[model samples]
Target: MPIIDNPIVLSDASLVLIEQKKATANFSHANWGDEDLQPVRREIREHYRNVQRLVCVYCLGSVSAHSAAGAPVEHIVPKSQHLHFMFEPENLCVICPDCNEFKSNRESLVNPVLTANRVNYPRNSALYRIVHPHFDSYDNHIAKFNRLYVECSDKGGYTIYICNLNRFFRRFGRCDELVNDVALAEQAERFFEDGIAPEQP
Candidate 1:
């Protein structure tokens, strides 16, 4: 994941709808009509896919519009927990299904009251306990080894733990087995090509 510029350009009607929802305290996605919700949903996915280069903002997982599990629009501050920011552009990001499912309604704010009082979207990453896609650069926190996630900062560590980044590695041995086998095959290839084998102890 990288710090991607938000490319979603909400239509005037959509903005009006958001404002109306805010005024009415009606932030439920299920309640919105197809005409209002569908376009916004489509635009969100399209723009984010382009801006994020089709990578999940949380785990850097590959996301494809054509995939069985397509990228989902995620609320950085869960809408359930922060209704005021339900439609805030900065609060929205695209994430993989697994990350989204695991992170449901999980709070990320360093201070809820401070975050809730923002007149405008906050730009300071320090305000958040987790890496905010809008406010923080992904590489600054997390280091990656193939599919393995390594935390370089507290935010990265928290994000990995909350999202269960190593879920596959923990639930199954296939990841390690596949990686080890690939390494072995590559090593054998190098030996065969060189017509030499290094001395083994």
Candidate 2:
């Protein structure tokens, strides 16, 4: 997937535009209203695509070099239930078609946002709090062992199962075991952070 190398989130006004144009954004290619917004959408689309290639927040796989990517700006907390975060630039992320499909509306357990009592991260489950993109590091929530970043020791097994990182790997490929997925994800994280190339992987 495209990795967001250096993300400089847009201002709140841009978030307002995103919120105002939410429903029709898909149809309009994010040009829901205001003639001036046309340029904003164009830039957002372009930047989202580039960011996906430059850096990957959690999914460590490198994007395919074959085709142009689908640059959908994903809501880290999801927009369907959390209306307030519809335009949050910090919540926005670029993901590949496969990762997007796997993540499609699938609620994250231990939502970090709701742990802080925000409406952005919904209470998807009664078990684990949602993991927030705004807070909580993936590493802290899920510690790396053999090849999997299992749930942090503090949270227990329920929280690890809650995150559903395994389902993510299954959707991509059987690259690792449940534990291994966590490890590989951590590997990908280090890869992105340390500037390791695919040549080494």
Candidate 3:
């Protein structure tokens, strides 16, 4: 994982839809999974996927939007606890399904507070116990070795524990995936030269 610059700008239509949903749902959990919110979810997922180069934020695993079991928009702050950040762009990022499911609704920070009086979104990295995709760079806190996810800082360790990133690699062979990626890349090079496409795995 590396430092990712995510520029999540919502369209005017998206803003209007969000306001309508907020009014109807009264900022409840219902608003988070509303049918009208699918567009927003898609937008967030696509944006982060691009920014993260289609890799999982926690494990650096490959992800595909086309795959049925692909990346999901992860809430940095659990929406169940902090409903106010349900639609906050800075609170969202795309991570592989393994990380998403393992991290579901788990509090990853110490003294996690949502303040309305703040002038802008919280920018203090020290406030968060986990590695923040927006506030902290991944490489600065964690280092990866083949399939192993190792933490170099407290935040990195907290993130690994919350997401069960090491367990995910143990369960799913990341080395095998890397081999597959390399083979696919080689096949692509051959296809460009010989005009022959490889069969889908």
RMSD of each: 7.6, 8.7, 9.1
Best by lDDT: 3
lDDT of 1 by residue, 94-170 (tens): 88899989998788888888677676766678888898987787767765545666676899899999998878777
TM-score: which is higher, 1 or 2?
A: 1
- Predicted candidate 3 versus true structure: per-residue lDDT over 1-201, tens digit per residue: 234676588888889888888788357865676787888877777788888878787777877867535978888878787777777888888888888898889885566654543445566778788888888877677655445566768988888888887894667655554456776557556755765534421
Candidate 2 lDDT over residue span 28-68, tens digit each: 32233358565554555556556555333444334333333
Please state the error at residue 145 of candidate 1 in Å. Answer: 1.0
**Quality of model 3 by C-alpha lDDT:** 0.73
lDDT for model 2 comes to: 0.48
What TM value does model 3 have? 0.77
For model 1, the superposed segments whose C-alpha errors exceed 4 Å read 23-35, 67-69, 173-201
Which scores higher on lDDT, 1 or 3? 3
